[model samples]
Target chain A: MSRKISYREAMRAAMHEALTNDPRVFLMGEDVGRYGGTYAFSKGFLDEFGPERIRDTPLSELGFVGAGIGAALGGLRPIVEVMTVNFSLLALDQIVNSAALYRHMSGGQFSVPLVIRMATGAGRQLAAQHSHSLEGWYAHIPGIKVLAPATIEDARGMLAPALADPDPVVIFEHAGLFNMEGELPDDWTVGIASAKVRRAGKDVAIITYGGSLPKTLAAAEILAADGVEAEVIDLRVLRPLDTATIAAAVAKCHRVVVVDEGWRSGSLAAEVMARIFENAFWELDAPVVRVCSEEVPIPYAKHLEDAALPQPEKIVAAVKGLFA
Target chain B: MTRKTPVNQKIEHRPPPPPAGPVPWDKDFALQLLLDMLRIRRLEEKAAELYGEGKIRGFLHLYIGEEAVAVGALHALAPEDNVVATYREHGHALVRGMPMQAIMAEMYGKQEGCARGHGGSMHLFDAATRLYGGNAIVGGGLPLATGLALAAKLQGETRLTACFFGDGAVAEGAFHESLNLAALWKLPVLFCCENNLYGMGTAIERAEAQTDLCVKAASYGMPTFAVDGMDIVDVHATMQKAVAKVRKSAGPVFVEFRTYRFRAHSMFDAELYRDKAEVAAWQKCGPLHTFTARLKAKDAKGGKAKLTEKEFLELDKRVQAEVAEAVAFAEAGSWEPVEDLLKDVHTPEGTVTAAPQASTKAGRAKSPAPRSGRRSSKPTSARGRR
Candidate 1:
């Protein structure tokens, strides 16, 4: 009983299910109501769920987001959308200082139980302001959980577990993946703690997550045609990373190519490669290499933007470089 | 909307002695108000002493002159109500029912501290009393207080959330946004702006175009009240009125408590901002001395129960001894083992609600509720709080 659905629909479905089932769950963010969400994820939710549940907020990210933390503490589940990761910077204090630190600072007296979702990554020609892959920066924080949902299944499934998790969870929904069509099963509910090996091969491993997963899988197809089998690992959970699964993948393939859209200097790819080194250093057949975004603000020009990001060719090149 | 911004706004602070000579109330309750204020006055005096003795470290913000605001405002709210305070919060925590020993132990970085010493001096937290935190960031507690009020509304609870910030926080976006949100949503929030004239070094008039905080807060469409923060009677009166409106689920009320800080902003503050003359002038109307004078006045001159010198000294002696016991408690408190350093980062496994099945009454984690006046319930599916 599987049906084809877009990544956006899966996300909407997850939110819809959570809102429909639990009285505590409510969506609050700019344009989430009235405007039906900047991404149209909550298009008709305002009518279906009403404005109280499907809340429309002003251009106050820090206020509403911090309100979400308080609401959670007050004993309600709040799904706070930031519109985009770039705008999340305005609310960074509430997220990093208040939400992330509440439980620890309160000496385990309070758990935020807040889910903050924001669209991340570049591709819509939205220059520097509207586009960024800053989930890695959030992953650096200790108290909050960071999730990057790359697949339709994850987009549909991850919200429930995230809302269920006691601590603050930031879900980075790649802006490029909203229209991504894939088969979603009747049972799209999946656990949020592990990474899924999207495609497996014994020769070399190509690891990535969020928007880069499809590109890495495409690169694997290209590698397969060239008689070089590439195993693909999709890092679903960015924080509290599924190290055991990643270690097993590295041990199986012996060589790895990490792809990330964040900048090369202190990118998530760098973290993945570092973890591989620490956890599976002895299992490596060759030194791991990473393909990260070129160091520059993502440009407005399509060609320049494409060059700044990790494409299938870039992933293929990085994998071939690993084999060489 | 443009106005001439003053470079150095001279605060024409005429510390008026409270006009209401005798607040006609029960003798015990009236004495209790004085008791609470004296307790904070003495506790913080000891805290400042301990800071010098090297027993406490890391930004010990003393509530020296601002004792009236914490005591008066907090006493107005019920225990079931929520409280969010700023870094200068030992007075708020103590008055709100957090044990002075735990507060001192926290200052000593002991496991017996309210936050298990993780939060240190500026970050005391007590879930049991519903004191959300000693939020160090200026304007940070506003949104948290607003959100807590939102939860109260959503949960259909009558308890209000009392949030205390400073004049400095008025310059922050969190303050404006929180005020706007709370007003728009009509949440039950008691916004206590402890306007101690300066935000660190910058005076309110210098930093803000509109020195009138009530006007700025009223722009958000919420009712605003100004109180003589240095006067306990005014502070208590203003809070009772504001809390009455908010407690009825009327909406958020923004209050500016006009007062002054007698000390530097932090242990590190060189305090090159304000002049010594100005500080000395404000000290002339210190809350404790003036209030004590009023209470101990002759019975014919509006003092119904003239608090005799003997009674005042006995009360002072009691608080002084309590401060010493708190210091002893901190000294005897043990350090949390390094092995437990990694603990409480996340709700330890099994306490959190595992992924819910569709449409089930989210098997509530049996954790103590964050706030519980008469509004206590089994909370939500989130990880166990305490």
Candidate 2:
């Protein structure tokens, strides 16, 4: 049996399961309770879980994020929501210095079993401050695991295992994916350790994750129309990148084009390309290339915002360049 | 500099601190408090001596003059309560029941330390005591304390969290945000601010437009109390009241312990900020001698009361011996192998829990501690003595 659901609904279902199954699990964030979450993921959780479990916080991101780390250290599985990736910078010190370093710094005496979920990407026309995709910055951190779930099944499954991990896990839910409609099969399970091939082809390997996955898939379809088969690999776990799966895909399809919504320099795509060079450099029939956002603050104008982020046309162009 | 006026001049116009009455707690408890303060003083002196000899290397912030804040305040709370302290936390770690050997070994960068040498002096941690961290960032631990209080409330536990930060943290955005959240949520947190006047060479008058700090916590609707940090008696009483109220109401209370740091901020500081006369004046009002004199004079039963000159000497000798033993233990401790450097980066996969080192003699034997260092013969005068 399969269930048709929005990515937002699937995420809510996952949170609802965790909150219902575990007494230690609670949700806290700005607008997560009374305002039904900034994305309305917890529409009825406030009334159901009560104010104690479904907490609403002030604009104090650093304070609450630090509190979340403390709550985790004190033995509660807290799922904190930072409304967006941009605002999370305010709490970066707590996340990087405190939460991430606590377990190691304390010499295994502590582990922050914290999950911070935030919306990222540049489609909302929210301009400079709110529209940058900075998941690469988070993935660069060592002690924390980063995940970018681009599908409904992952949206419903990753939270459980992320909550289970003994360290901090940051989930970047691209703002564009929430409203995406997808089907969830009864036994559709997911793990946060490896990449998944959404579409298979023998000619070229198109690698991406999060919001860029759909655009890359679309580009793959466009390439197929031109007789160039493209295999699409979704890097489910951003940190601890699944080099084996990427290597296998590279072996089968000698040409690779990486797609990311972040700017070109020092992006997650750069890390992926570097890994590809290190692990599967000999298998490459062509030099690996990347389709990344332009190096500019995401603008408020609709047309400029579209240009600033990775699009299907850009991915298709990058893939064709790899062929050329 | 635009204007060459000295900022340390503001120290002359100081607020009148709370008075130190006779030893309010019974003889045993008061003596225990004095002993704890002595333990801090002697241990730091040995640590300073070791630092000079090049054994301990790091930004070591000795709690020479501010012993009463951690000693008196920690005594007022239960064992289950959480404690979050600033970087200058060797004293806080000691009084919270962490063995001196573990603390010293940690500063020595050995595997037997409280954090297994992962954290040095600025980041001591002990899960057993529920001490969160020796956080180095200014105002960093405030939010952690507020969250610990939140968890205690949500878990239906009566444990309150005590967060200690210096006056330097008062001007931080974190202090304001954490206070606002705790007040709004009614979390059981004790914001213990040790106001030592200078925020690393910047006086309170210059750093804050409104030098009165209670007004900041008050703006968040928190109940505020200011006590003389030099008086261990006052520190204990104020924290007792603060802890009790916070537990009863399940709300946060902010207490500002007006104190002084008689030493340079750290081993690295030049001591160029304040006048020597001011240090001399504050030393006369020090928590140790003043309280000792008051205890001796108020003994109505005369000559052989609980805290006699002989008893004080015995306690001092005991403290000196303990410092020597801890130093010996640290000297004998082993460094962690390079291969195990990545061991605790993230905890090992299995669902392991915190196993705090035992504070008993059997526990101290966990490390191959050598009790061979020569003991200091007598209790020296207070450290950082120019």
Candidate 3:
């Protein structure tokens, strides 16, 4: 018996299940307790989990993230939400130098089974400071896994497995997906290492993940309307990327376009293109083109902010440009 | 504060000795402690040799002169207690029960190393022994120790965390923050500051405005002590007492092991930090030989005898053999696969919750609603808002 739910509800259910099932699992972050999370994901968590587990931390990312590492070391499974990726920079030392490096550096003696969840990507009218996608940066680190969930099924299923992993894991929830509503099968457990093909087509492959999936799909719909079949592949896992699926898509489509909110320079878009080049270069009819955010700070102006991010029109144009 | 001391000595109070002089432990236990320290000494000596050979690279901070502090201090605690040490912590890891093979492998950058070769000399970690880190960042482990202690306290465990750092760590903000937090929370953490006179090349006198390490700790309302780290007996006794006090009161304690390093700070040092004469003067109080003499004296009082000069020579040969074995183990250990480079940062469970099935349905269903929030829609200009 499957039903529809919002991305926010699915995430809430996962967290609620974790807290209810595991005595050691606890949630902590800014506004996670009383204020019900910065984005309202934990609206009823404080009352449900109480202050001990549903802790609200001070505006000290380094302190709390380091504390999360400590707590993980001390035999607790901690889910630390950092509001967004932009704020996670403050705790980069703990995340990069400490958490990610702990297991391998400790001669494989210790494992930091900790999870850090944060909102990511750009969209909405929120200006430069609040907007941006940086999951690609986190994927660069070794000893840790980076995840980006673009749909409701993923929102409901990633947390439990992340909690079960023996090393540190960072989950990037695209800000654009939280309010999104969707359906869930009664039996669907999404693994963190696989990629999904949303819309199958043989002419062109549209590769994207996180917030850009919707836009990419919209562009695919437009391409289909014009009798140009475009395949849409969703990259659920960033690190240890399921390149097999990407290769399969590119191998069949013959042409590909990568849509991302990250800047074009040294971005995930570039990495995807490189993968296509490595695996399906001979199969490609044209060079891989990417529709990424403009290479500038997102502005405060509403139209400028929208203009700077990947739009449906932009993705459609990019997919069309691939044929040209 | 009440005053009663030899005025000058009052400025630097020595720790009060235990009432029973010291426990008359058997020769086996005594020799075991000595062997552990020697193993560290010889292993580090070979590391210096390897650095010279270019087989090992990076900042190789050897614990050459500071063996007794780790050896004696570690012997005082149970295996269940936690340990947090600095970059110069090969000796601590060995004594805390990390196999010499792993430590050696780690130094050699082999996958079998303590941190699986991910952390070299500066970062040794042992999960079975509860050794928390090979933390390279100055003053980084203090807060971690405090938090571990806090967790133990909250969980109703009688465990304690002993954190080791050089005197230079006193200047870092983490040191003060940890001390205050530990004291305020009454967490059971034994702050063991190895006052080796220098933090890298800078002498403690030059780096610190107030050189009294114990005084700085005492300011946080924690009980403090200063010990002669060059003397294994002093280090062992003072640590034993501090451990007892913290266990009974269940609060934090601070001890400064006034020690010295016989070698350079790292492989690159040119011996310009202090005079060779000063080094020679301190070597006279070398822990190994002097501790042997003290052990013999104590054994003689028991109507038996300690190990003879030949036994000491034999012990050194055995330690050297162990170190050699460790090096071979490290040399032969494998490297972690590049494919797995991204495995453990976060667990593999997160990909499940990312893109929901319903979201896919929603994308396929009615009008697509824009998912929007705090972050900007544009990629290039992402910054965190307060």
How do the predictions measure up, each by TM-score?
Answer: 0.94, 0.93, 0.80
Predicted candidate 3 versus true structure: per-residue lDDT over B2-47, tens digit per residue: 3333322313223222212333567898899889888988998898
Clashes found in each candidate (C-alpha, N, C closer than 3 A)? 0, 0, 51
Evaluation by DockQ, superior candidate among 1 and 3: 1
Which 10-residue span in candidate 2 chain A carries the lowest summed lDDT? A16-25
lDDT accuracy of residue B18 in candidate 2: 33
lDDT digits (tens) for residues A1-324 of candidate 2? 676889998889778866765667789999999899999999999998899889999998999999998888877778999999999999999999998898888877888888999999888889999897999999998899999999988887788788777789999999999999888776655777889999999999999999999888889889999999999999989998899999999999999999989899999999999999999999999999998999998999999999888999988898888777
Candidate 1's DockQ is 0.45
Give one digit per residue, the lDDT tens place, for model 3 in A83-168: 98988887787788878877656644566778999999777767888897888888888878888889988887788777767678
Worst 10 residues of 3 chain B by lDDT: B368-377
Q: Could you tell me how far off, in angstroms, the CA of residue A81 lies in candidate 1 after the best superposition?
A: 1.0
Judged by DockQ cut-offs, is candidate 1 incorrect, acceptable, medium or high?
acceptable
lDDT of 2 by residue, B104-125 (tens): 9999999998888989999899
